[model samples]
Target: MRLIAGATAALSAALTAVLLVPQPASAATQLIGNGAFTSSTTPWAAIGQTTVTAESGWMKVAVKQVVANPWDAMVAAPTTAALNPGKSYTLSFDAYSTTAFKARATVQYTATPSANQLLATDVQLTTESKRYSIPFTAATATDTAAEVTFQLGGSGGAPTVRFDNVSLLETQTTRPTALYVSPLSNPARWAGDPANDGDTAKAIAADIANEPIFEWFGGWFGDITKAVDDYVGAAQAQDKLPMLVAYNIPNRDACGGQSGGGAGDATGYHNWITEFAKAIGTRHAIVVLEPDAVAAAECVTKFGKDPEDQYRMLLDATQVLRAQAPNAWVYLDAANATWHAPDKMAPLLVKSGIANTRGFSVNVSNYFTTVDSETYSVAVNGYLSGTVGTKKYVIDTSRNGNGPYEDDTPGDNWCNPPGRKLGTPPIRQLSGAEYLFWVKVPGDSDGQCGISDEPAGTFDPDLAMALING
Candidate 1:
């Protein structure tokens, strides 16, 4: 329902359906010396109102007084190597407090009053020891005399803290193999709804709810950061890769269709996407960014706005996700196989920051066969061969079993086409595609077109049953 035969307005006013990690890196170079504290505390020191000792292979600190700030009482050690700007690093350590409290782990210059700080993160401590791994980029210039310190103060009461196996290392980005299966998916929720009982719920659970699907997010979200944090936190708890669709862009659905709302303007879009990326933080994720965004730029010209402005917005969004959510694998949407030729779409994607992303996504929220999408994606990759290098792609295999609705007119072919069945189930590295995802929820209505009169994005069980039966 997102794009028609061409990147133009729909025949009818069809409403488009709306839809961490911080794990340690492997094969990294340790940048901190004497991290295990096995021998003695030579370079380490207890800063204020505390006693530090190395014994039993762990550094123990006994706090003598409560302080106003965490930095008031700290256990600090100088780094063995310099930290370079723009390089990714991870700080991992095992720690526990005699009493439950909070502390700060900071990376800064060794000077008494450092001018710049590279990383400072708040950490919660419990009676039981647990390992914490934090990933961050060096935001400042090279610091040869930097130090890693643990600030244990401002807890309203003194508490003893222990640390072990502390290590700081330079790391690499690794994509996750397993996709997260959220229990919060639309179909999964529908299956559990009291109204949907017996066979309906069972069918949904078996055919759709069990599959991992991408969740769509946009400007409608009130607390965008919390929403993103909750979703990513859930995925991290399960040690799975979460998939998301970022659909909100200013002047979205510029075709003057039902799915027309977005952030108020370009600045609003940048701020919104920035917060979204920050919430994902260091967690691993797959983002299908702004479906139809690149393709629909052509329509923005009719609104008396430069299409280049839209491209710039998308490119900024890509940069934000790249810098803020380092572990996330982003795929800029390239519409579909039928919308634009590879030559036409290639340059658009390039201008829209495809180079900053993992790759591009095709056939999002649309009905297109996986084979056709693979062909189109391969062609686009060919055009981008020298410019963007070897880029990967994903296909939306939600509902294209019967292909396009040939019986209907070209204008209405994309909206709720009857006889359409669920395509291949979502899988990673399937048929040369990086991933095949249910980008479009299978049972959701496209608009008041073809067989469905429901509003866009509303669930229709009867329609879902038809697709499943086929």
Candidate 2:
């Protein structure tokens, strides 16, 4: 068995190799040899006498039951993460069916299909041409099979399905700005009398169109399980995925004071996240796991905290959270560029179980520009680099238009900078981020900034105004 704990030295060496050897500009590529079916169905095959035609830029399928045959399909070898293994990959294809009929899409272990070979057969398609990708853990990394296919049969009559851009892609890991991501989040508090310290809207503004939000479930709170369940339920009620910031590491915010400490210790955090995962249970959520946990952990010694124990929490947290929230997209927290260097942070990240999670998040509650965050992410991913390296990032762009404050004195600038404006609004797609989010509540207090009397976590109208208008 390849135990991750025992392989720390190897991971460190691999990380060193990643940094020393210059890598490529990108690692993502189309998994399908001929997904477009542009000129020929070279990689695809006609299943059980089914007919498939590769036309202009798409593939046309016609399947009919001849005798006792149940279904017919167009199958192709499936490389799970397509270009990269274990890269939060998703299956995507544009399809237009002639009639509103039920169609089956599945991953088979081999061209000669078997029951155990069937990976997923739950997706159903309609007549309209729409882009599709399952949000749940319908396709896992091990779902890699000999052939995945689209089937049209076992119906009243013959069915015709036309498909285009059929391919496997690393979910959330797109080139600079090529792929348009479709994952969603954001919630302006859906519980009882909560502080809108950073929330500009009183009621989450139902009239306003949808936008993604990321909430960090940090520090030690009451009933970890119940709290997360409520968060997940609330987000789903509003038709949004909860971007849960899993920020309860024991030595969290090691470099900052506004938010430090976790659920007592590593064992306490493991217990907390275990219950937190139990609460999440199959919810369609986006977990931005442990902001400042790893980056700041670099300073554990300064605070009399154990860095090894903190790393243990990160490793346990990733495995537990993902296993529990099967549908949730989990990202490890990598503080903004203003915080740690990529080389310094990369080893810490890999050591803290970055490879186990979906990717990482940067600029969370910090005043770095989106461009800077992207650049930082590219460098970090490079440090964890490989042709199929499975590391992606999310940027918190709630407020950064004016960039970071020009603080040189005590340099406590990040806490409510003087003239920072709102950064890019949360959207379904951002240039490099899996989801550009309003991670930190835009108007939240950054621990008084040495100027305002507003207590930490209290609503500050002035701070809100500055972010909204400055």
Q: By lDDT, who's the top model here? A: 1
Residues 1-470 of candidate 1: C-alpha lDDT, one tens digit per residue: 45765322223332222121134323335667777888787678999878899879989998899888787888888888777777676676788899998899988766532565677889889898776666677765544467899999898889999998776765434555567777888788888888877798899889988887888899777767656765765565455678888888988877636577789889999999987887677768889999888998989887798899999999999999999898899999999988889999999999999999999999877777776777788889999997987688988989877666675367767778788889888876623687778988878887777778878777788778878987
lDDT of 2 at 130: 58
Residue 376 of model 2: what lDDT? 81
Q: How accurate locally, in lDDT, is each candidate? A: 0.80, 0.60
Which predicted model would earn the best TM-score?
A: 1
- Model 2 CA deviation exceeding 4 Å by range: 1-211, 387-390
98, model 2: CA deviation in Å? 61
lDDT of 2 by residue, 220-302 (tens): 45545445654554444334456676777765666666665567777878887877775666545677887777766667788
The runs of at least 3 residues in candidate 1 whose Cα sits more than 4 Å from the true structure, single-residue gaps closed, are 6-175
Enumerate residue pairs that collide in model 2.
185-213, 186-213, 198-443, 198-444, 246-290
Q: Model 2, 333: alpha-carbon shift in Å? A: 0.8
